[model samples]
Target: MLKNVVAVVLEEVHPFELGVACEIFGLDRSDDGLPVYDFALASARPGPLRTHAGFSVDVPYGAERIAEADLVIAAATGIQDGFPAPLIEALRAAVERGARVLSICSGTFLLGAAGLLDGRRCTTHWRHSERLAARFPLTTVEPDVLYVDEDPVITAAGTAAGIDACLHLVRKVQGPEVARGIARRMVVAPHRDGGQAQFVARPLPAEDGDSLGGLLEWLRHHLDQELTVDQLAARAHMSPRTFARRFQQETGTTPHRWLTGQRVLLAQRLLEGTGEPVDAVAARCGFGNAATLRHHFGRWLGTTPQAYRRAFGGVGQPAGR
Candidate 1:
């Protein structure tokens, strides 16, 4: 249903965020049997648009192009405080007509300006989350999540998360086969749940001296094994209390929480790349059983293992492979 797509740009747009939309929707992949969107770039004020990266892009279409789009993406721009009235109206019209709108990073500000985010759950980059919330008091800004999909408006956090939001839209509308095919071509993960946390600007303080990095790597390799705080602490050569404190300081989450997150990520990869049974995938990811895996999957990804595989399983792999 999302056949036509348009990226609405404003001056001083971030090239990478705009490129995210273009890469996912604008590229011609018909040779792969993937849908080729009727994609175009439109500017709120047509002509040469400056990018934050010191370059300018010549967008040929004007705001009117958005009217014909099935999906409208507002690319991140430096100028978010005020949006052109025509652009805002076009966005409102597009949404009113049942077209979905997406915002990458700071682009949520424009949606806020358009009053589209009012009383809706949305998010922007963690760095700008507070400002967005402050400016749009009516909207609920969830700062930690990578993205938020509230029907007509999908807002993604900084940079790469835009890919997650875009692929999610594809998966929801076209099915996982198309999304996975595009993701395979893009060489990126097809689906990172919107609930995943944004990596903080300072993930680990430099003073930590990379002491836990090796341990973390070891834990990843041993995810199938039953791990506990004591074992992890022993592996890190610290008291359990010290390890717990240090882990939180460095990772912004507890050891158990981080391990569970890693396991969930492993389960996701297994589900997408293989035709393994739900129980096998669960065991491989340390969930012990299919029921347990299902519980975690529902809590973390808002979907079941079977459903996820059906949506994103490898193209040629057997259902029971």
Candidate 2:
């Protein structure tokens, strides 16, 4: 049923996101017995346009192609000084015709500009999550997730998260089996639990040239232990002050915030995948108690731990994923 896909490329469109659309639908994988999707890139004007990375591309298709598309994708691009009226109309027309729509990264801004996400659940790159929320208060914003699949409209985080949204579309259109096969071929994880917090600005590699990557692996393995800033700094052989400053610079967040996010992520997995008591789950995730977990969950996710589990846990079906 999903035969044709139209991707609208705007000025300063990110090449990586455009490439993601091409890789997922533009390639002919019929030899592998995959359904071939008719994929085309369109622009408001059919001529060479500049990209975000300082290059120009010539797209042959124009806005008219979108009218015939079964699915439409908006690739990430730099924001214009103001929204382009014609482009917004084209997007609105496609969505009005019942075409499934998707947006990658800042592309969500375009959807907002077109008034498509007025009452929809959507996400953009976490860095822009606040902006999206401030600009469109009526739209429910879930910044921590990799993508939000709200049936007809799907939105994803930055760059690589676009792949997750595309594969999600494939899984919905085809099946999980087909999606898993493609993921394996792509050498990416079959699935990522939690959300974009799992990939958000991570702490930089240790300056000691020891590669904190291994240290992080160890920390994950020992999350149940009480972790202090001093202990974490010691692991990297730096003074607590220096470590704290560097951690914020590298991860774009403080050590305390990152730790809290990790613990919450762990608690979510436990709550969903296991029958562990909330108290035990909290302890394992460094919350030390169910009340703590519940408090943080309410603060960050706008729900209690029990409610979150019931909504997204075993035998519990979330209204949307």
Candidate 3:
């Protein structure tokens, strides 16, 4: 049902995001037995629009073009400037008529300006997450996730997350087979759950004379061992209850959840970098058995270990090869 699509291009549109929309919805994939969208670009007043990369693209359709679209994309653009009033109203009207509207990265600001994000949960790139939250106080922002899908108004983070969001929409509407075909053609992942965390750059957990920090590094190196809160509490020289509270305050997550996240992250690396069997990887990560590892990996990543290896780790290659 997601056939007609239009990208609303504003001045200083980010080319990578505009390209993301064009790549997923604009390209013809009918030869691969995939549905081809009738895609075009539109602006508030149809004319030449400059890109952030110091180039120009002539947009031929006006805001009225949005009336015929089943999906409208507010591609990433300059967020500091005011949006055209007519364009904002067109976006609202499209949403009112049951058409889905999506924004990529800083394009979320446009949705915030249009009042489309006032009551919904949304997200943008982590770099802009705080600004988006500060400017749009009504919406709850989940800064770490790749995308937030609140029906009819999805918002994606960076450019990669934008592709994930589009493929998600495709899979939701047209089925997984079609989504996989499109991804194969693009040579990207067939799917990445919208709830997956963005690969945010974080400082290493250094043990610079910090008690909890030292414990974190130790846990990383000893992931093969079964660690409980009581043992960890004793190691830190605190009662279990006090340790739980302090750990939560320090990491923003429960001890168990943090350990699981860490284990899953290690599993991801092993799956990507080595040809170890699932059972071996499970033992190495202290998952006890392959079944337990599969259960937790699927719960955390929305995919099986074998499937992840197929996508990331070279199939059948030896370790360190």
Query: All candidates' lDDT scores?
Result: 0.88, 0.80, 0.86
Q: Candidate 1 vs. truth: CA RMSD?
A: 3.1
lDDT of 3 at 141: 96
What's the C-alpha lDDT at position 212 in model 1?
82
Give the C-alpha miss distance for residue 216 in model 1, angstroms: 3.2
lDDT ranking of the models: 1, 3, 2
Worst 10 residues of 2 by lDDT: 193-202
How accurate locally is residue 11 in candidate 1, as Cα lDDT from 0 to 100? 85
Best model number under lDDT: 1
Q: Runs in model 3 with CA error above 4 Å? A: 202-321
All candidates: TM-score: 0.85, 0.64, 0.67
Model 1: lDDT of residue 30: 93
- What's the true lDDT of residue 170 in model 2? 84
lDDT for model 2 comes to 0.80
**lDDT by residue for model 1 (105-192), tens:** 9999988998999989999999998998989999999999889999989999999999999999998899777998999999998887
Q: Residue-wise lDDT of candidate 3 within 117-205, one digit each (tens)? A: 99999999988999999999999999988898888999999888999999888876776667878999999986775766675223344
**Which stretches of model 2 miss by more than 4 angstroms?**
193-321
